[model samples]
Target chain A: MEVHSSTAGAAAPPLSPGDFRELFDSVDAFLFDCDGVIWKGDKLIDGVSQTLDFLRSKGKKLVFVTNNSTKSRKEFAKKFGSLGISVSEDEIFSSSFAAAMYLKVNDFPLDKKVYVIGGEGIIDELQLAGYTGLGGPEDGKKTAEWKSNCLFEHDKSVGAVVVGLDPFINYYKLQYGTLCIRENPGCLFIATNQDAVGHMTDLQEWPGAGCMVAAICGSTQKEPIVVGKPSTFMMEFLLKKFQIDCPRMCMVGDRLDSDILFGQNAGCKTLLVLSGVTTLSALQDPANDIQPDYYTNKVSDFLDLLGA
Target chain B: MEVHSSTAGAAAPPLSPGDFRELFDSVDAFLFDCDGVIWKGDKLIDGVSQTLDFLRSKGKKLVFVTNNSTKSRKEFAKKFGSLGISVSEDEIFSSSFAAAMYLKVNDFPLDKKVYVIGGEGIIDELQLAGYTGLGGPEDGKKTAEWKSNCLFEHDKSVGAVVVGLDPFINYYKLQYGTLCIRENPGCLFIATNQDAVGHMTDLQEWPGAGCMVAAICGSTQKEPIVVGKPSTFMMEFLLKKFQIDCPRMCMVGDRLDSDILFGQNAGCKTLLVLSGVTTLSALQDPANDIQPDYYTNKVSDFLDLLGA
Candidate 1:
């Protein structure tokens, strides 16, 4: 493996197996990004499950923090179980859950509902937080071809519009969500995440929740309060929920813009793993603003420090 | 009526009935925006038919330029017929037709087809221009929930991705369009227009083509070549097709941003009609960049100019 001496005067260097001892000693909790660091698609990276178990054995707090808001925390936990990782819903903090908690903590009006432009995950979380609203696959409909004088019957009880990744997104959902935010006075606009694109596999990537969020923003000319990685909202949510000690926490991930930047914004040490979207060359590039605290070939490389 | 004295150091004033004679004598061709200038919703505004007839009696060339790309020129002509206005399909210049002409003039490969993310209008125009492709309501489908390892079968013959307003847009359309642009090397991206918000009525508005365009742009991080009002592309197309004298042409419209700006860009005199979106206060606002050469209450107000 080519070793990259970190530029930009940050002194970040490729962590040797011997350096793992200092990393383990420095952090009490570990936050991980899912897609690249742990697994790619349905298959887990080699030795990830064992490394996670080793971290747990070392009394390090393990938490899965993902910007993917298409699935609820329970669903994510189920996926983890399927992957042979024993994880509770409490240990999985998805952007959907962050949005729900944000609304609940803000004391969202019980009389008002959140107009959602997302999938079942966002709906389930909003329901769990006791917020009612319209959205999901059931709300999908073909919109009228032309603008007509016929008045549309809108749900006046809608107080917020929450957007996330929606595979079943249609014109009606966008139209109705736009209407709620534009017509309804003081209607809060929020997005579960702002991931520009979602990597499905090495050969496939699609528009993520950020695309849907941008559609609404383009139409309404209003920027939403984004609540996901890279934004401090999700980090703040995780910090308060897990009671994490800032200096003793480390975020480990594959992407520089979201995962590594998120860790830096959250006041935690960050470890960059080369198992996902970002490469060592990307980190070494002077144009990139965010840099992780350390770098490794993969998450399983930490096994060397454990003498496994 | 509140008269607006043009603020940007350009001398523009609301034309009085006496000034109408000189305005009519100055221009040989009349170009008009369909929606707020000629008709509002399904009903025609007062004196429009009479004013149009009066212009024809004076041997003035008539043309309709609209940003709405939902219908073909034939369809627009039919709508004009329904409104008692005598218009030929050749006289109508729509964004869809302009897109088709653009591809045709650029000598788009006959073997390749355009991947559309719009309605039948764009499809019809492309077909008329001898370009084959996919899009319209038939392509609307809910994409698979997760990105799978199963290879996505993409049409290799697609050379361009054209986006416009689509009422039946779904995830699969967005996914396929994104894949075509990102996966295919040198695939052209085009948008018919970028209208931010489409007004249905005073109380109802929906996300326009710009929203869908933004979704695709957000995913691919690629900006499209726009070909509609306010973008000089359509104006250049009209100028080439009709071979009209720019100084002898006058553009009449309701919106200052699209129609008026388009006329100014095409080197034509512009007249703003208050029958649609723009109000007198908006014209007087110092913040607006584009200004028309003259102002009138409505399109039919030109009847007084012809002494009808």
Candidate 2:
């Protein structure tokens, strides 16, 4: 059963088929990041379909986990199809989706306009959930002279302020948003995710929505109720969706901090993928030894080993 | 002249006009905030124009100080003209302009694209001073996915990261910008202002660029080279611009934490205005007793006493 523990304790070269098979035979459910492993900017990984089909044949569950707050469940499904991968909207878990659901169930002020500084996914979800969306004036010049009250109406009944993924987020917006929450002390503030960066193609990383959330939270002395992965609420939702036990299930992801930490914190097996942000070189170094219970190069590579 | 000698050390209502004049007679310059003091949205304060004109006739210097990082000197000039106030671009000093000038003179990074999650003042000033500007992708759909490396050939070569008035700044942007600077170890990061909240209208106080700057600086473990008012650098700049000794000049403004503190720290006379952010009550209370050399109901009222 202990197939190749040699690479397990250390960072090593890419695994062989035998090594992949030896490692993947122990996991039940799998979680994954979308951009780096299964595909890169619309091109599917070399052998992803076969890998998914093999996993499906073995009755293993697959869930796509992403910190990208820009895509909704439906949009993700469409994106997967466009990239030649078969995934239903239900197979995806997004920070934006979790935030929307959290808002809907918690009796948050939905009718009031949510000052959105993020992407289509967050905007679309807020709209779908029957919340009004507030936009800054059309001209960028207006932002300079625009006051906080002018940016958002002084409806004493304004609902919560939701901050999702916004790249153009600047000083005025931060100022205005902070003012609104500070002025209306009763309004709830929510951030979709707390990710600091996302792994892009070509091995470059970019800042994510979490950085903004942290900044505003620090200023206002208010922390957001994060709705994405590693949060027990989202994990609990996944458990209910698949009717799985939190203890016996497995959580597989490429990120050691988010995925592995989430798995460990939730009492599940953690399988760290070598295909994304966390590299084998980092894990294998004696100075840094945060080893996941299982290891694989990519989603498809792990599937090959799971056939045992 | 001895009106305040009886109550010099005793707690009293902030100096009345007669009491204020008896204690301090000579006033050289007047400083004002643009928003609530002079105008709200595109409208001037009732007596703001006439008061400035009278002061001009008396050959008194007037400078507008704003914590707003969204506009540059030129932009503020145009805004002032639109609001029926006579002003040259030089008469206005924004935190962005101050920070930009600081960066340019200090030779921080002249060639790198400053990933600006801020306003045009920050962008335009940096661009004019010979730095590239990084913004959200034009596609709009790829807004969240926008990365800065596209603007430059290599990420390591990034010289400095500047943050101003960006409402859409998120965790991704903050983390990436911070990491890039942290990894390089020599990259200079500058923030426009440090005011936590500014009153946009009588109704609300918006968070300022300082909040975001605080977050990034805290994360990176670096203090920015601040050029905003109240900073010693700014006092030095004013000293050089006006060719006046720091002790002989005066800084008149509405806020105590920034304006009054600036004067106090710079060894200049500080005049507190009742028309803006901090109230007379806050100044008199022992808990927040930040007494200015003089206090006036408004910037205009202070000008009246100057025989303008």
Which candidate ranks first by DockQ, i.e. highest? 1
Cα misplacement distance, residue B258 of candidate 1 (Å)? 2.2
- How far does residue B269 in candidate 2 sit from its true spot (Å)? 5.4
Worst 10 residues of 2 chain A by lDDT: A135-144
Q: What share of the true interface contacts does candidate 2 keep?
A: 0.29
Q: Model 2, range A1-308, lDDT digits (tens) per residue?
A: 11112324555345566655543455566666676667654456677778777777778788887767777888999988886678898888877777777888888765566665466787677777777656332212224344434554444554676776565665556665666677766777887776655554433555556666756775675788777766655676677788765544666676665666666667666667776666777666687545566667777665455443
For candidate 1, write residues A187-261 as lDDT tens digits: 999988777676655445667887898888877778889888877677666677788676678889887877877
Model 2 C-alpha lDDT per residue in residues B17-39, reported as the tens digit of each score: 57645433355665566665676
What TM-score fits each model?
0.89, 0.70
Tens-place lDDT per residue, model 1, B191-232, is 888777665444355677888988888777789898888777
Alpha-carbon RMSD of each model: 4.4, 7.2
The Cα error of candidate 1 at residue A272, in Å, is: 3.5
Clashes of 1: 0
